[model samples]
Target: MTDYKLGRDYARQQDQNDPLKTYRNQFHIPKDEDGEDAVYMTGNSLGLQPKITATYVNEELESWAKLGVEGHVEGKHPWLHYHEFLTDTMADIVGAKPSEVVVMNTLTANLHFMMVSFYQPTKERYKILIESDAFPSDKYAVESQLRHHGFDDQEGLILWQPREGEELLRYEDLEAILEDQGEHIALVLIGGVNYYTGQFFNLKRITDLGHKYGCMVGFDCAHGAGNVPLNLHQSGADFAVWCTYKYLNSGPGSLAGCFVHERHGNSPELNRFTGWWSHNKKTRFNMRGAFDMLPGAEGWQLSNPPILSMAAIRASLDVFKDVGFEILVQKSKKLTGYFEFLLKDLGEDVIRIITPENPEERGCQLSIQVKNADKTLHDKLTKSGVISDWREPDVIRCAPTPLYNTFEDVYELVERLKKILNG
Candidate 1:
């Protein structure tokens, strides 16, 4: 544990020593009324824009203006194989092999597509399992999947809820559920990092248990992708999906990523929704040829790459590449740990941090519950120049992204909140 102090000078001193300190300048931090940079702590919801994003986006615009139709084959970065450019870096970020990863579609879209292939449900093993507090979108998607398969959504859905009165999930509880209904469950889809509590689950442990009982396992890594080091391939999950707009610093509603374990890459028997993009590149343009599926995650692609969105993703990825992911994760632990340290000083009677105390079990986000406070508290913080996410009723989610947030930012956020709580 870090020996955290209670003053602003300490925070600035830590920032001065931070190797990643200069990166804060690379992003365009939101401005306050005085035109000063706001203490932007909502990277988990939407990351700040990188200053260079426009340059990359405009390159694609120039290509379209100059080369027109020929841009697909003749541009600086050809649109024909544009998605391929993101493969290696994204694979490295998520700890998967290049062949097993691809950037495509939106988060829920990828999840549904992955389910089409992995959620092979028999009449007996037709149920799907997810956390009780899963992101509403994930819950809705899974419920719809059950309904689409002609099963009663309510009966087919199994929730691995936390024990009564507890906020974080216990592994033993998950084990117990799997032991009881493993055979009946065809799919175990979990958020790699639970959005509500910022709890990072043990993916490998869950995957192993699910596989033990003949269940296909997958993860919605929307909150984990750039915020934490998710070793997706090592987790032995059948499939995984994540969005790029949050910790990835990509533009809003940008394309997402998908991972298929290398083991299933060549499984031609697996059912999937396919398009010409999934066909063999050589034969893709040869209209007369029969459908030939490309092996690996690329085979999941349903349409040609969207270059403009991809360019923004590429730009953000370049920033990640410049600062290696390992280094980013190292900085994340320190920043969040420091944030936790300061919040704890605010007194447990007044402040409660529901996120795991262990740095390994979370990313940079800390979900805070101000005792006896409501949404008005969140609104006050916003007015005080602290841009954060407010979960209904009481929780305030603050993520001090390692890429651009400083120790001072974390310090100021807590101090501002402390001031509000005091009054």
Candidate 2:
């Protein structure tokens, strides 16, 4: 078992030595009824707002008030090309070329847009594959796509399921399924990190397997985008989509990011749903001519975005640019490892961690399965000022976000759990 001292004083000492502890002050940590900062462990659901967020957003609001129509091109951060300013940094976060990434629409909306271009199912190979426990939005999106193509959703959808009585998915089982149904599978859409189990799937391995079978692969990276090092370009996926509201620490319902591999950047022949914003910016106002699509992921955009939402995303991306994903990921492994160590010390029978045993196989979030416990156990934790999320059945999800969460946070959380479970 890993060693972690179990006292409050030790927890405080860990925080004092934490490299990323200062980042906590940068966000407006949520408060309780008494106005104390809650433990705030649910960054996986909605991140705390960075204090700078308002400043970034106000700048845009000011430009709009002053310049009106001309703000599109004349504002300090011009509305006409505001999205461009975010490209390089966002690309670095997901490990993609600037041409391959675009920040646009919400998570599910971007998923549908990517499907329009990549999920080209034919009669011979029209089936879609995904994890059985995938987020509901993703399952619905894929099912709807199969229905749109005139195929029976039941027949066209294949599930890569975990072993019976097992909480985690197995790669060997996935390989077996692909070998059996490779010819009929059209696309493989998976969560890069499962929201429920917190399992970070191997993107490159899955991409390689899908391509070997002549299948197009895509990922829903809502839980993985900022929590893990995606390396989307090197993974060689046909497409990917993610929300920024979670680990990226943007505001609630912020703009999502989409990526298309560089090989398909200039393929006008590829099917897509488009809008005026996706038209070639150089000649967008010359509207009387043919529809000239912008290359890469930008071509998939369906409308002009809400600049206010983009402003929040811009503020968060600036933080990411400053920290660098490499440094953040390094911290993540240690912080999460510390969390796992403390939790496991509580004894396996009372608390079972459902996420993968291997640190390399998951992100910072730990989904704890409290034995025979109910929502009341979660309530007690909340009453004690621990801010964790309770998923249905019996799991409580706590994420020690590397950008802000310190080792002390994790240590206190586990100590609190021990007190609760012992009672």
Candidate 3:
């Protein structure tokens, strides 16, 4: 067991020495009525905006006002290829080659676009597998795809469920489903990180299992994108989609990122819904020929994207570029470990952490399950200036983001939780 005082003191000391600690000042930390910074642990929902975001957006707006239509080419950020500027930095963060990644539509939209190419279902092999508790949007997208293919969703869909009374899904269970239904399953679509339970699934292992069963595998990484290290290239999945609004800190409802494995990059035969943007860049504006798709993920784009949203992503990515994911993840492990350490000390009888205990199995978000206490406890914590998320029934999610959250932030949050629980 770690010494409580030592842990508390060490947390404070770590904040003092932290290289990324100064980044907290770069964001506008929310405050309570008393003028104190609210713990701000909801980065998992909507990340705090970087101060430079407005500046980045305003520059584009200024160019629009001054140059009018010429802003498409003459703006400080050329609107024509604005999305291209973000590709390299985003590819680095998601662990994909530049050609494999593209910034495009919102999360659900990208998922649909990916499905157009990857979720090809045939007569015998037509079933799609997904987590039983997948986010509502994903469930809807898959169901719609099934309907579009002339198959009843209930018949064409397969759900990999957790064991009775369990909050997290097991790989063994997933394997069992694949073994029993492997013959009929055509695709495996999974959430890279469970939004509610904060469980980080092993992507490579899942991909391997699905491939063994002759299934196409894809991932919806809304919660996992910036939260966990998703080596999409190494994971060998056919495709993946994720949003930037959460851990990527690209503001609310930002453009999403999609990855298409290099193996399929040049496969012109692969089917996808296309538009002018997906045509060859050299002759894109020629506007007089058949649709020749661009190679890799860029080929998936259906239309020109919103430049304002891309600007927010650019600003946030610049910060990530400066610090690097390696350093951010290192601090994340420690900060979240401390949060877990302190929560465990509160005793499991009163408050149970639903998230996995292993650091490698999760990012920084911790889902706390409070016994006998309902949302009231969450309300109390909020009143005390701790800004955490509350799910229905009884779960409070607190994400100690490494870019801004300090060790002291974790310590203080736990202390507040303990006081609320004891009272």
Q: Which candidate do you rate higher for lDDT, 1 or 2?
A: 1
Model 2 C-alpha lDDT versus the unseen true structure: 0.89
lDDT by residue (tens digit), candidate 2, 193-238: 9999999999999999999999999999999888898999999999
Local distance difference test scores for all models: 0.93, 0.89, 0.90
Q: Write the per-residue lDDT of candidate 3 for residues 1-423, one digit (tens) a residue.
A: 334343578888889988888899988789888998888999999999999999999999899899998998988889999998899988888889999999999999999989988888999999999999898899999999999999999989999998999999999999999999998998899999988889999999999999999999999999988778999999999999999999999998899999999999888888888988899988988889888889988998889889999999999999999889889988898888878877877888877898998888999999998888898998999998999999987889999999888888888898888887778
Residue 29, model 1, lDDT: 92
Q: Is candidate 1 or candidate 2 better by TM-score?
A: 1
* Tens digits of per-residue lDDT for model 1, 323-396: 99999999899899999989989889988999999888999999999988889999999999999999976799
Stretches off by above 4 angstroms in model 2 are 1-3
Clashing pairs in 2: none
Q: Lowest lDDT 10-mer window, candidate 1?
A: 1-10
